[model samples]
Target: MERPGWAPPGVDITTPTSSRIYDYMLGGSHNFAADRAVAEQAIAAMPHLPAVLRENRRFLGRAVRHLAGEAGIDQFLDLGSGIPTAGNVHEITAGINPEARVVHVDIDPVAVAHSQAILTGHPYAAAVAGDLRRVGDVLAHPVVADLLDLDRPVAVLLVAALHFVPDDATAGAVLADLRDALAPGSHVAVSHASDDGRPPAGLRDAQSIYARADSAVTMRSRETLDAMLRGWELVPPGIVACPAWRPEPDDPPSAHFPGYGLVARLPHPA
Candidate 1:
C-alpha cells in the first residue's frame, strides 16, 4: 500500500494503530483508511467510544494548563501523545506561556510524522518517536534533552497511555524510574480506564477490537493506578473520573465514563 503524504516512510500504513484509531476517534484527518475501518468496528461495538476519548483529551488539556499556568512548569514530556488534534499539549501550554517547551513522544511513526509536520515553525515544540515504556531512551533522545531540562520542574503526561502497558509490575517500575529521574516539584498526569470490575457488553466488544492492535489495551484498576503513583502527591479532587477532574463548565457531560484522571506533584527534597 502506498503511504500517505503525512506518514513517514518505513512504517506500515496498512495495519491499524492505536494512535491512528484515536486520531479518528477525535475526528482528525491524520488517520488512514485502516484506522477508520477498525475505529468503525469499535464504534459500532460501543458508540460512546469517541466521547470517551474526547473526555480523556480534555483531561490532558486541563493537566497541561495546570502545569504551565499554576504549577509554573515550562517543559512538558507528553508520552503517547496521539495525532495532534484540537487542544494539544503545546497548544494548551502556548496559550498560557508561549515559551513553554513540549516534546511529544509516540510509538507510532505516523503520529510522529504528523506532529513534526504541524510543529514545523514552532521552535518550542517537537515530536519524537519512542516508546514511553522505555524511559531511558525517551528521556535521553536529542529532542527531549534539548527541549527539556530534567533538573528543573517538568510535567510528564501519561494521558490514556498506561492502559496499554498491561503489567502492573512493569508499569510501577517505569513510574519509579521516572520519579527518580525527575527533580523535585515535577508533576505527572495520567488518565486510564480501569478493568477491575466486570466490563459492560459494549466495552467488552471494544476491547476485543483493540486486542488486534500492536499494543493491546490492558486496563488497570484504580488501586493499581494509585500503587504506581504512590510517591507523587495527589492534587485536589484526586484521581476522579476523567471528566470529573477539574472540569470546565463548557465541557460536555459524560454520564458514566469509567476512566480515571489525576495530576500529582513530586515534592521538593526534604
Candidate 2:
C-alpha cells in the first residue's frame, strides 16, 4: 500500500485505523482506503452510525464549552481525540481565556501527524501519539507536562474513546489514576457506547466490522458505566444521551445519539 503524504512514516497504511475510520465517518479527508473501506462496511450495516458520530462531535463541543465557560477550566486533555476536524477543542474553548492550552492524545500516527500540521501556528495547542491506557506515560509526557498544570483544574475528555479499551480492569485503572492525579475542581467528560438495548443484526455486524480495525468495540452496560464513574459529582442531566446532556436550541434532536454522556467534577477541599 502506498502511503499518502498525509500519513506519518510509521503508520501502516493498509490496515484500518479506528481514528481514521472515525475521521471518515465525520466526513473528514484524513483517512486512507483501508479506513474508508471499513467505515463503508460499518455504515452498510448500521446506517445511523454517521449521525451517531456527528452527535458525538456535537457533544464534544458542548462539553468543552461547559468546562471552559461554566467550570472556568483553562487546561484540556482530550483522550483518544480522533483526527483533527472542524469544531476542535482548542477552537471551541481557548478563545474564552488567552492562556488556555490543549493537548490532544491519540494512538493513531495519522491523527497525530494531521493534528501537529494543523496546529503549526497555534502555540497553545499540540498533539501526542500515545495509548491512553497507559495513564502514567500520558501524564508524564512532555507535551502534557508543559501545557497542563497538575495542581490546576483541567477538563479530561474521553469522547468515543473508552469503547476501544476492551479490558475492564485497564479502563477502570486508567480512570482511577487520572482521577487521583488531577487537582480538585477538575472535570471528566465522557461519551461512551452502551449495551442498553438489544442490538439489531446490522448493529451487530457493525461491531464485527470494527473488530477488523485497529481496535475492537466493547460496549458496557449502564451499570458498569456508572460504576466506572464512581467518586465524582455528576452534574445536572447526568449520564444522559449525548445530545441530551446539554442541547442547544439549534442542535439536532437527542434521539439520534444512542450512547451515554456525562460530565463529572471533583470537589474542592472543604
Candidate 3:
C-alpha cells in the first residue's frame, strides 16, 4: 500500500492502530484499510460499536465543559488523544474560556501529525507524540511543559483511552505520577470501556480483533475501574455509565453502552 502524503514519518502504516480505528468509528477520514478492516470486524461482532464510540465522545465533551465551566480550569492535558474531530477538548474549552490552553498527547504518529496540522497558528494548543503509559516521558515532553503549568490547576483527560493500556501496574503508575505532578485541585476525567452487561463471546471477539491490531484492548470491572482512581475525590454521580453522568436532558440514554465515565479531583493541600 502506498503511504499517503499526510502520513507521518516513522509510523507503520500497514498495522491497524487504535487511534485510527477510533477515528474511523467516529466518522473521521484519517484511517487506513487495515484499521477499517479490524474496526469493521469488531462492529460485526457488536453492532452497537458506533453508538458506543459516539457516546464516549459526548462524555468527553461533557466532562471538558464541566472542567472548564464549573471547575475553572484554564489548561488541559489530553492523554491518548485520537485524531482530531468534532467537539475536541480545545474547541470545547475555547467556548467556555477563550484563553484556555491544551496539550494533546498520543502514541500514534498519525494522530499527532493531524493534530499538529489542525492546530497550526493556534498558540494555546499543541500536539505531541507520547505514550500515556510512560508518565515521565510524556510529562517531560517540551510541548507539554511549555503549554501546561504543573503548579496550576489543570484538567487531565483520559477519555476512551485507558483500555489500550494492558498493564495494571503501568496504568496505576501513570495515574499516581500524574497526581503527584499536578498541583492540588487538579482534576482527572476518565471514560473507560467495561465488559459488564455485554455478551461474553462478543466482547472476546472484539478484544481479539484489537489484540491483533497495534493496540490491545483490556476491559476492567467497575470495581477495578473505581480502584484505579484511588486517592482522588470523585465528583457527583461518580463512575456511572457514560451518558448517565450528568447527562443533558435530550441526550440519548446509554444504558446499553458498556463503559464508565467519572471525574475526580485531587484535594487542596492542608
Segments in model 2 whose C-alpha atoms lie over 4 Å from true places: 254-256
Give the alpha carbon lDDT tens digit for every residue of 36-76 in model 3: 99999998987778888999989998899999999999999
Q: Which candidate leads in lDDT?
A: 3
What do the candidate models score in CA lDDT, each in turn? 0.87, 0.87, 0.88
- Go through the candidates in order and give the C-alpha RMSD of each one to the true structure: 1.3, 1.3, 1.3
Q: How accurate is candidate 3 locally (lDDT)?
A: 0.88
Q: Give candidate 2's whole-model lDDT.
A: 0.87
**lDDT tens digits, residues 1-270, model 2?**
667776677778899989989989988989889999999999999998988899989889998899999889999999999888988998898668767899999988888888998899887899998889998899899989988998898899999998899998888787788888889999999888876776644777898898999999888877788888777789888898788988999996745455789999988767
Clash statistics: count for each candidate: 0, 0, 0
Q: lDDT tens string, model 1, 66-174?
A: 8899889999999999888878999888889999999999999888888898999888999999998899899999989998999899899999898888888888877
Clashing pairs for model 1 are: none
